[model samples]
Target: MAKAFASQGDMTDKQISFTEVGRDLYAFTAEGDPNSGVIIGDDSVMVVEAQATPRLAQKVIDCIRQVTDKPITHLALTHYHAVRVLGASAYGAGQILMSDAARGMVAERGQEDWDSEFQRFPRLFQGHESIPGLTWPTTSFTGRMSVFLGNRRVDLMQLGRAHTAGDIVIHVPDENVMFTGDIVEYHSACYCGDGYFADWGGTLDAIKSYGVDAIAPGRGDALMGQDMVNTAIENTRDFVHSTYRPAARVAARGGTLKDAWDAVRAECDPKFADYAIYEHCLPFNVARAYDEARGIAHPRIWTAERDMQMWDDLQG
Candidate 1:
């Protein structure tokens, strides 16, 4: 069997791919690891997600410097994942933005999450000491917010909850491009440790409704054309369904948590086994799916202790 925390063993460096998905829209992808989006506006720049630490984020800064000298005035978080938001301080952004719901999540369990994530994925948090602390958003919006980089307008919208209750997407209407956080993972395993499976499907539909031509997902490669964008969405939707269906079936049949987990693996592994974080995410994903299948509305906070308990009970 794989190690309890599979990602703890992942330390090989991944080649980063920084590609321009649209006119001024860029995606910084590192193999199948967490991805960040870059938007160069009329005069300033906006970074969609911050990497794991200040040190890790500096690599992104170096990449940005290669293209534009514009100041990174804004850092917008898609959600409250440690690898995604903890690097906010590195940007030195004038404003760090997130949905109001995301900010609330930070207040509720941000510290616990930071501890849990740092333990779960050590490779991503290489420069752990550099994280000054939890990243709290300077500006938060309830529904929608618009930011202007000179004449360019970027819309930040909280369409619906998927990976987390506060997940948001950045839309560039003029370029027909979008930066979806973990809300849309291209070929990566959807880390549903705190996800809402049913709602996530609806959220995917809402993302499609935008009719975006290019998309920068939270993980995997960037989708450049309409066809590839649609495929990524469809594949993500399929992964969600494949994971939840068997687990829900097991739950409905009064099966044990292990039973539900095994059922999910049996159903989903064939298709998603090669995806990034597949093994590392399965236990937590199945646990959450089991809860949601049994009608748990809000996801429970995952502390480092609780994470280990779940891992032992399920994966052990």
Candidate 2:
């Protein structure tokens, strides 16, 4: 089964690939499922964003082996999204890294996110049995950390929150490449349930400041070159704006939740009809946006059953 992705459809079954974007900077992509990044340093490797399970993470590990035999010394999660972080154990990294806000979110709603995402997208959770539990970062930083892997410096910075309260981006200054975990997606759906819509655009801008030549976002193919880089940032901005702002406006106008959904769809579907998983992100996006508009600070927990009920209600 070869892995592939539709802008909006079931992800294809495939083995996945680790594409080298620059010197020692590789992107391990699993069809259209969430992506993982590997930075091969002089002596060791740092993997960013583990897959859904160890079996899945091992698949990425095997790909990393093809490039170098460096032991994975660290697994750096960009945020606390279950689909993105659950595969940490497979990396065998003695040190797992994340943000303070991310750790808080895990303590807040990690279990619910685990259940909610599992039910929402089962295919991505391909070896669910292999998952030990929620992925936790042993080393968490507030803003930034500079890791010197034998002099190949990599900067991990929490530029600003967008996709979540704790989204982080990895910058390899030498290669001028960035691994943005869902902060900026290229041509794929921008998962925005826990995202701050207005802040997302700025985060994209913050990511752009690195003058990234290549970027491997949370989903979709890696963005290569400056032109594609610009497109990715703008596309993510568009998705966040299109989905959340309209829903927020409608929710504020005393419109029914269903009305907010309709308004969001009408505004987004036309512009983002070609984006990957646009439909999948809609119901959750609306629910979150409605909450935000109504003065909810933190996003409500989403259980599997509640996910279906919300989807059913919105889709109806």
Candidate 3:
């Protein structure tokens, strides 16, 4: 029998975990679902990665209320993916920030991504009607920008490209804790459909140089302690490398997309078969790697139509 299309069959609700990675920093994670980070400051808070919709984002808000009653003053989106930004209205944050590249993407292909993702995983889009529209940042930055919540400083930087061309990491200098958007993931598949395979590792290296005490990764459990942080970063590196190498090899041999898919599975399945969203991400990852290996510098925009077509072609 043919496999279910992308995460459509994953209807079961995941248990949510709100863990404090630092004194005032928290990670709101739901079993491999897109995670959100909370940074509580002296008088306000800044949130990273809004969930898919208003209803979903409210869950993060609920989690935030449990810890502190600080008003959410900033919403910093790390990228332009629909799942990460569509919930902007729910936060009621006065300032919404993104990298310039990310804001550009929102203007270019944000709706296509929104439609594509909504179809790929219906469960995540619960209360889709509540989404006001495509999320646009009130402020856009270049390399790095800092926000001061009273006296505490939070640095948001475009370290390098990994998950997307505009990925950013949020660092808390006081606690030495970082909220790495999708640039780093723990025990979860890196969704590389729009990623730069060649630049991902260097981005990981940049993140490693910080030697952070704790990290609330894009997904999976909140990483606490240097050892756990290091393990997740290296594992993410291995996952990216393992997926790209075999697909690149197949492309080098002038192989078909299906051929590249098979090669990547052979190389990645043994190690990452049990990872969250591994199966859902494999086909897109292989497709992007194949394109990159064939000298495609930029990833093509994914629409709902393209999503179905690609799935049909690969799963056949």
Who wins the lDDT comparison?
3
Local distance difference test values of all predictions, in order: 0.91, 0.84, 0.94
> How many residue pairs of model 2 clash at the backbone?
5
- Off-target runs (Cα >4 Å) in candidate 2 are 1-11
Cα error, residue 314 of model 1, in Å, equals 1.2
- Per-residue lDDT tens digits of candidate 3, residues 146-179? 9999999999999999999999999999999999
Cα lDDT of model 2 by residue, 1-316, tens digit: 1221122245567557678888999888755678999998999999999988887788888888888998999888999998889988888899898999999899988999988777677777878988998777899999999888898999999998788999899999999999999988877788788888767778888888788899988988888899998988887887888788888888778887889888888998888877767767877788888888888877777887787677667656
Q: What is the TM-score (0 to 1) of candidate 1?
A: 0.98
Off by over 4 Å in 3: 1-3
Weakest ten-residue segment in model 3 by summed lDDT: 1-10
lDDT for 204 (candidate 2) = 82
Top model by TM-score, which number?
A: 3
Give TM-scores for every candidate, taking all chains together and pairing residue i with residue i.
0.98, 0.94, 0.99
Q: Which ten residues in a row have the lowest lDDT in candidate 2?
A: 1-10
